[model samples]
Target: MQETVRVALDAMGGDNAPGELVKGAVDAVNAKENIQVILVGKEDAIKAELSKHTYPKDRIEIRSASEVITTEEAPVTAIRRKKDSSIVVAQTMVKKGEADAFVSAGSTGAILVGGQLVVGRIRGVERPPLATLIPTTKGVSLLVDSGANVDARASHMVQFAKMGSIYMEHVIGIKKPRVAIVNVGVEEEKGSALVKETFPLLKECSDIHFTGSIEAREIPHGGADVIVAEGFSGNVILKLYEGLGSALIGEIKKGMMSTFRSKMGALLVKPALKETLKTFDATEYGGAPMLGLNGLVVKTHGNASAKEVKNTIFQCVTFKEQKINEKIKACFIKKEENE
Candidate 1:
């Protein structure tokens, strides 16, 4: 029998709240037979949106939440004060074992804070990291500590490398994923104090395949399957990568439309180019997951559209099926035993 994965979705969160969020929930249920979505928000608003869609009645549910958490509010304070907020309620469901996962396109701080406080962490996890998959020429690479743990220690980076390798190998279906630390230069002697300290520890890890340093320029060429860094550096690399991809795509379009002769060439390449670009659309893989949590917590873009929301919801199903949390717990426990 297939295990049903129940996801508690924050219906009142995100820039396109209630509308796109509701549509995404409906779309998710329609797309997957073993998935169920519990929409948490104002009952009237949720029902009003649901009235417009045609979906399986048994697969979608509604839970009333009175308040909504905003991005500007401090994370800890907002979570403490807004007990009835959609984000908190959804996270609570995961903590209580009522749901297998929590998904939100809400405040990043709130999600991270709530995930650690509400959903809790796996037993041996010192610090949970936000990991996202970035598109690469070979395929996708897992970026650990993407926007979490800004002031991480060498021990944290070492943990990040191990967890990232596990994620890529299990969830992403890669055999012996290559792990690399983000560095300015390839030399063993280069990098900051933290990277320098962390490098040797990662090298000593026998479970993961440490492939030395990976410069930012080589990331696009698929130099490694897992990229490790502290939150500050990882976040910067992520933003730069996103901005560059957008700019390059825009320039390609502009160049293709500049002259009549180019227009004919553009028509010839349009189909192939469109197909090629689809592989790079990060939304296809869903949101960034906060790893090491007791239950899964995924944070999507604040302005995510229905497609992104839907994809994230489906991603939850795969996570549950793979028993990722159990694997993470065992990995950390075994490491502690060895130490």
Candidate 2:
């Protein structure tokens, strides 16, 4: 198989590291013939995990990293003190251009911190935001800064919209994706000072299909293709979305089992409902990418299965092939000059 993309997988990262993490890396390599994976972590521990599988030897290799970064540790301190940790080592591989991308399921804060501080942002990028693809009624919407840039400004919101548009258009193949700033309401005067200022900025930008403001309640209906917001609001909205989905599923399951009649009906409709709900599961979307950086960094759930891990790895291929970073820089630079 011709290797087109080489990814650095943090074998020591994630709750299931060296086990699920190692298995995920091997599974990704097995599924994608053109992709190669370099596992970074304790060699012996990684070997123990790999021993359970009979993967092609050429497709996977383990790099040594004695220390492991814990999710409890502070992002800055962990990155600095745990130089030999798998997460740190993986970033090193990406920084040195030895790998095309890096994937971690351990500490999201560390990944975001390392991505900007270590991998750094592209020239002209003010602040990099973590972007995630959320499944919606109309299909999927890209949420910009879902977990980064908590203190972003209106200018930053405008930049997020533009950068997100480029990603959705070029990488996600959503031509002319409607970009909207997540606000308290659709009305121009309905938000904190930030939303009010960002509304006109996004509307004035001719490059993106600015759709004005999007309310959190309308997010599940896929109100916009690219939803832009400061990390604070975005994070709250996303967490609620995930929580609501879980709570709904639980209620439906319990309600169906309350009586024989409902149980039978549920049995008949279980397959369809399960399939439908599966699409909304956050884990199904894999990790979120930290955009505006010089290189790609994806953050997956700590309990991510091999399937989710594989998706996160494949996501990098599109980011690289589509030249998302280059296009994002161009979009902002061009938009900036117009202002």
Q: Evaluated with lDDT, which candidate comes out highest?
A: 1
Question: lDDT tens string, model 1, 207-274?
Answer: 89999999999998899999998999999988888898899999999999999999999999999999
Model 2 residue 206 CA deviation (Å) reads: 2.4
Clashes of 1: 0
- Model 2: runs farther than 4 Å from truth? 1-3, 333-339
Candidate 1 Cα errors over 4 Å, as ranges: none
- Candidate 2, 106-126: lDDT as tens digits: 888888888877788877788
* Every model's TM-score: 0.97, 0.95
Give the C-alpha miss distance for residue 182 in model 1, angstroms: 0.4
Against the reference, the lDDT scores of all candidates come to 0.92, 0.85
Q: Report the number of the highest-TM-score candidate.
A: 1
